[model samples]
Target: MGIELITLLIVVALLGLMAFGVPLGITTLTVSLVTAILCFGERAGFFIVAANVSEVLHKYELIAVPFFVFMANVLERSGIAKSLFDSMAIAGGRFRGSVGVQTCIVAVLLAAMSGIMGGEIVMLGLIALPQMLRLGYDKKLSIGIICAAGALATLIPPSVVLIVYGLAAQVSITKLFAASAVPGLLLASLYITYILVRVRLRPGMAPIYDIPETGYPFFKRLKFLKGIILPAVLTFTVLGVIYSGIATVTEAAAIGAVGALVVAGVRKEACSSP
Candidate 1:
């Protein structure tokens, strides 16, 4: 068979395997293994696979993956996102769909911190969903906002998707992060704008609701400032170091991971306090 025909068959087999509920990684591996065995001798196929695996393992870029994942998990566990949500809820002002707007803001902040959509979704579902429902937000609008805004994690900085793409394409991860920033923010703006417009046009979808005051002393309200500081430091330390040529991608990832841990620790302590 021609090379194109062989590739087509492999893709078809991959799709079939995935359709059967096989894990995606396993399905891809199986398809590639079969294709290699068919195209080359069994011994050559084994050697080729081994060589590719070694190459992948040896790539320095792969080191960033674990650091990013660690940073994301630590941030998720921290109370930083909740603080941001509270701050944003106040900042959103008293208007129809204000909480929904704040929910999108929370999703953006969580995405910037976590770089994983699932965490944002879970966080919002736990925090924002009940609040929105209690406030009589339209079910469709509430759910849609959570799902759509949470998905921004994929395109933002510290994203695992961009890291993997950089590794596979032999591009600079730092550059990818910098280049993706504008587009990610643009996409987020679009989401926020759409949400606001929708709420405005269909006021029934999101109604104005009471937002309780912090009821804290003037000094205590500074917790909201903490919500913004850590994320700004993280974004700057990670992307800034890379973009400014102060550190390599791996080094930046390391810095970001440590920073995230420190932030999480501080937030944990703060939450533990009265």
Candidate 2:
């Protein structure tokens, strides 16, 4: 068979196996092994697989992937989202449909902190959904806002997706993080604006009820800053270390991972207390 025909047949077989519900990794390996053996014999095929594995293992950048993932998981469990939503809810007060606005803001921050959509969406669903429903928010608007805002995690800095892309494309992860910052913030702003305008146009969709003042002294309200400062500092520390050339991407990721664990430890006692 011609080389082109053989290549096409292998690709078709790979897809057919996948379509038949075979695991993707197994199908890929099977197709590659069959093709390599046909083209260059078993010895060369084995060598090729070994070489690829060695090259991947030798890429030190991949080490950062696990650190970033660890950091994200730690932060996801830290109860930061509830605090963030509470603080932003105060900021959004007195504005029509401000609850939705605050939820979007919380989502933006969660995206930066988590860098993954699944956790952010889950957080929003668990925390914001009940609050929005209690405040008489429209079901459709609440669902739409949570889903759209949570998706920002994929585009924001510290995103695992960006890290993987940078490695695969042989590009700088720091540069990708830097480049995405403006666009991510811009998209988030647009989301908030859309919610505000929609809520204004259809006031019935997101009814505004008077929020009882906490009656606490002004200084007590400052506690709201607590929710924001730590996460913001962590985000800036990781990104700053990278952008300022103070550390490599992997080093920055390590710092972030350590920072996340510290935050989680500190919050654990407080979160568990009544």
Number of the predicted model whose lDDT against the real structure is largest = 2
What lDDT does model 1 reach? 0.80
Instruction: Look at candidate 1 and give me any clashing residue pairs.
Output: none
lDDT of 1 at 214: 41
Measured with C-alpha atoms, the lDDT of residue 58 in candidate 2 is 82
**How do the predictions measure up, each by TM-score?**
0.82, 0.76
lDDT of 2 by residue, 123-211 (tens): 89999999988989999999999999888888887787788788778899889988998888999899889988998888888887466
Model 2 misplaced regions, further than 4 Å? 1-58, 214-220, 269-274
Query: Which residue pairs clash in candidate 2?
Result: none
- Locate the minimum summed-lDDT window of 10 residues in model 2: 209-218
Could you give candidate 1's per-residue lDDT for residues 30-142 as a string of tens digits? 88787888889799998888888888889888887788777877776776667677776765556778888788777877776667767778888888999899888999889
The C-alpha RMSD of each candidate to the native structure, in angstroms, is: 3.5, 5.0
Q: Which runs of model 1 end up more than 4 angstroms from their true locations?
A: 1-21, 34-49, 214-225
Q: Number of the top candidate by TM-score?
A: 1
